[model samples]
Target chain A: MDSTNGSQTLEAQAKAFFDSAPPLQNTHQITQKLDHFIQHSSANGEARRIVCVTSGGTTAPLEQRCVRYVDNFSSGHRGATSTEYFLKAGYAVIFLYRRGSFQPFCRSLPDDPLVECFEPIDELNIQVREAYSEAVKRAIVDHHAAVAGGLLLKLPFNTVFEYLQMLQLIATSMRCLGPCAMFYLAAAVSDFYVPWKDMVEHKIQSGSHILDVQLVQVPKMLSILRKDWAPLAFCVSFKLETDSNILLNKAAAALEKYKMHAVVANELTTRKEHVVFVTSGDNIIVQRDKSHSGNDLENPLIELLSERHAAYIKDSNRQV
Target chain B: MDSTNGSQTLEAQAKAFFDSAPPLQNTHQITQKLDHFIQHSSANGEARRIVCVTSGGTTAPLEQRCVRYVDNFSSGHRGATSTEYFLKAGYAVIFLYRRGSFQPFCRSLPDDPLVECFEPIDELNIQVREAYSEAVKRAIVDHHAAVAGGLLLKLPFNTVFEYLQMLQLIATSMRCLGPCAMFYLAAAVSDFYVPWKDMVEHKIQSGSHILDVQLVQVPKMLSILRKDWAPLAFCVSFKLETDSNILLNKAAAALEKYKMHAVVANELTTRKEHVVFVTSGDNIIVQRDKSHSGNDLENPLIELLSERHAAYIKDSNRQV
Candidate 1:
């Protein structure tokens, strides 16, 4: 191969995967998760209630493999679709969705459905941007191949750890919010990530379990919602389990552990039907099981939850 | 209403729409349409190209509601469905979509396409997240309402200006990206916004004119790209015109004016089919007029462009 061929190959490779961010940590990062709730014993709905739905899935950008570092199976059935339902039911929908899922989301909702599309990670000019989305969009558009190819940018590791760091910044900012709010973490965040130590330089031609990825616990996002971020925002956590009783136990435990008003727990392999127990501090409201026309169980669960939330507000208000 | 009710309602409304950022001039906006060749641009073997799609719809957040905002329409059809074709063809996809359509997106791309979602800014704690999705999960597991609701604690806005300012900050940050890209600007960007003369809050009760909307140019995101951001990115700007010939001419002119590589032009009255003209410094590739199948047009386009780009590198090297 000639010099031209060599350069073309490199450019092709770069086209396939480019490292856009500096090879070092770019700047100070923020934690974007909400803090967990405590035993404030503050009467529920004493303050106002705002529901924030994070609708979409995220992938870790990788340079060498030209494949995703992390992935998920999210239908946004609970977040965006149910969001429209909630909005139609007269809730002012402040829709914070993933930009990549915009089209599909728009298709689900009508032209005007009281919605907002929130992107992420403001740019270098983060101060200029009001939404975290604009920051993320600017970064993606600024470094497409690099980011899409899973190359690490700004932060140190290309793994989910750095991504989590970035997420923390946004989540932290959210946790600082006031009272009587709801932060819906419907996004399918990855359970595991590759430790930086288990990395190979030039694409290890052979795959191996020898690459022992020591998975330290990623920061518990929903738990933090109960602890640090919003002492006031209502926190709802989901437990996707196979064992039936464990699901209920976990759901109840989640409410206690997080000091939350509601804990949503469901069996993942129930086939098309969904039965989620909305375990709250005062009562455990298990929504009746409903099978939908579609094969997915999440949609019906969301439908039940949306109504449950409304009832929660109404009940709280009546008591007051 | 009692004092408690009044205060709670006001707080709820305030929490509903948290922060805002002022709108900056569209100084950074520019449309980069391109022109591709015919004979060379074909879907063949060995050249599987990837296209980073930003679609559906998006709203440019503002500190204040005014004529000075830009929001894109996310019809969701052209990009999302077309994406199905791309996925079937075995090409990797970086799906950037808006929020409301999350269910549709989740429904269609349920397995894995590695998508990221973003919604508009009105929602709470979306901008204030502490760490990442994990932390959020943990937060919900720990606390239900307080921490997240506390995060909803934000400085309320008295006017549209404040809202626009908040939006601008988010927009800039979310879109920081790099090259070899493609942005399908099919989202209807809003040109008009409510205006507030002086500091007085003018409430538009029953009688409000459609013309009352004080229209203003939104920040030119395209213009931003045509200039510095993604130098090598292939930006496809949409031109909705009354005349087909005029649309083509205007598109070609736009390609040159903005130094764009390709342009997707359509007659406003036409349904479904888009007469896409691919233009660049060396070649003007016209994709024959046809109904856009809900599949990936990006790969075929990428295959053509990537090969051409590869060829350009080869030829340029020969001359040297």
Candidate 2:
């Protein structure tokens, strides 16, 4: 199919999916919380720059009862760490993450962190180990401060249906912010999914027969997101590939086709150590600095993105 | 294919898989730890039972580089909680679990637990909140005690390859324990998988086309495990079905075919509320106590399983 036809089909599929899906259980509550957070943060002419950081991975359930699912590989470390940096950079963050993925400020801790860091001082008292006290204190204090100041709002989803709907709600809620709003689409979303209507509602029986699953192309929502949902927001998307030869080309194509402000291109092997930013004009390579042992690539990447966002805001104001 | 041919084919495929896959990083250390735990526990006539509790779900990677995978639905809560009860019953547990799954004694805590349960007393101090302190302390104390005494050994795996390979290693290592060893297979193991030889080595590219994935039936290793690996050990497996019609029948078939000592049958919806234990003699229905508001089904379930294990040990001793 031609690009236009493909895009049209994807958009149609998206509409169909939305129409068929039951509304998320916490839609009203999430809306209320978002409205309260945004209103409170923007009050008194101290409107903080807002960034919606999508993290982790979206799952496509093969069975309606969901005994099995297809999942992308993501720890949500990038988005979680980015949120911390964003908070440090004086921006309000809307963290939309996969359920049970990494949480912001808890990245440095162990997987079962509570079981190790805590201790029974007496019957009613538990103290953090001296070794972990400082780090734990910093994380808790920063997290509590961010929540108390209405600078961070966390929303979690498991399935693809929940993610798309939640994304739409977040975008619409942040539409009033216009140029001050940004989208860091770092989540590793599934590209194909079985439609709910076609799925079986029970555990698939296993015996001698080979199991064959047919997955329809998941509708690309980037175009709709940029064009309709939050047109004036600064948006960035990610393109992860194993082949370096086609990574840049595919990223460029995505940038033009979806009208993304910038697309981050990364290879599977070197994703942790390096990434390339594909903008309209320039291709910038961002690498982890060996000199600073503890610093991550997100620190520099976020700095560059935030600088560009500031310039975009200034330019938009000048146009107005 | 006939059953004989199918079993032969599966064994061949398993052999091929083991040959092709790279060796796990910490095999030597894990084997050493298991040997030490088992030998020490069995020494001085204070022979505590050993149980290798496989918990959580295993993922089947579609790609060789594995950007995407098929995952079974499991949080590893069953395995983790069972480990605690097993420890309480004086059985040393080898917790082979999925990475990032629930840990024993930490089940009652919230998802984003550390952030909420902790308070920064000052710049360098952190303390568990009063409400959560008691629970947190109990968990920490129990976990530490188990670890310090060498009664618990945790081994984490992500993919099906890792889980199966690790299970084989553990089973072989525990063969010396004879009737004193038990296997509690609570993990939601995937039934179908794309073989390593046939898997793509890169991320599957997305376009305007339907994706068809062919998954071969996973080899049923339970029979091989019973006959070859640990013949004298007591093995209990789980059957989680959505439909009530065929649940008991399937469990019975599994018990007979795999030579399993028992099979715990549960419906997906009522798994936490009730389970039926199917054995050679009779099917015993185990239910949660509604009168005792805070009681867990595990309390009774473990008690019954332990009694059976003790009887099996006694019978084996008498035979010897």
- Write model 2 residue lDDT over A17-136, tens digit each, in one string: 787665788889999998888887788485569999999999999888888999999889889999999988889999999988888888887777786777657544566787877667
Whole-model Cα lDDT per candidate? 0.39, 0.87
Best by lDDT: 2
Q: Worst 10-residue stretch by lDDT in candidate 1 chain A?
A: A32-41
Cα DockQ of the candidate 2 complex: 0.64
Candidate 1 segments whose C-alpha is farther than 4 A from its true place: A1-49, A60-68, A92-177, A195-204, A207-212, A281-320, B1-320
Q: TM-score for model 2?
A: 0.97
Indicate the residue-level lDDT of B313 in model 2: 97
Per-residue lDDT tens digits of candidate 1, residues A1-320?
12233434434433222133223254242121122121121224343234555555443322233221333334445565545444334333333444434322233332212112222222211111244344344323323332232221111122333334444444454443343355566555544333343333222211121212222223344554555556545566665554565667666766765576666665645523445556653443444344433233444455555666667656655766
DockQ of 1: 0.02
lDDT of 1 at A136: 42
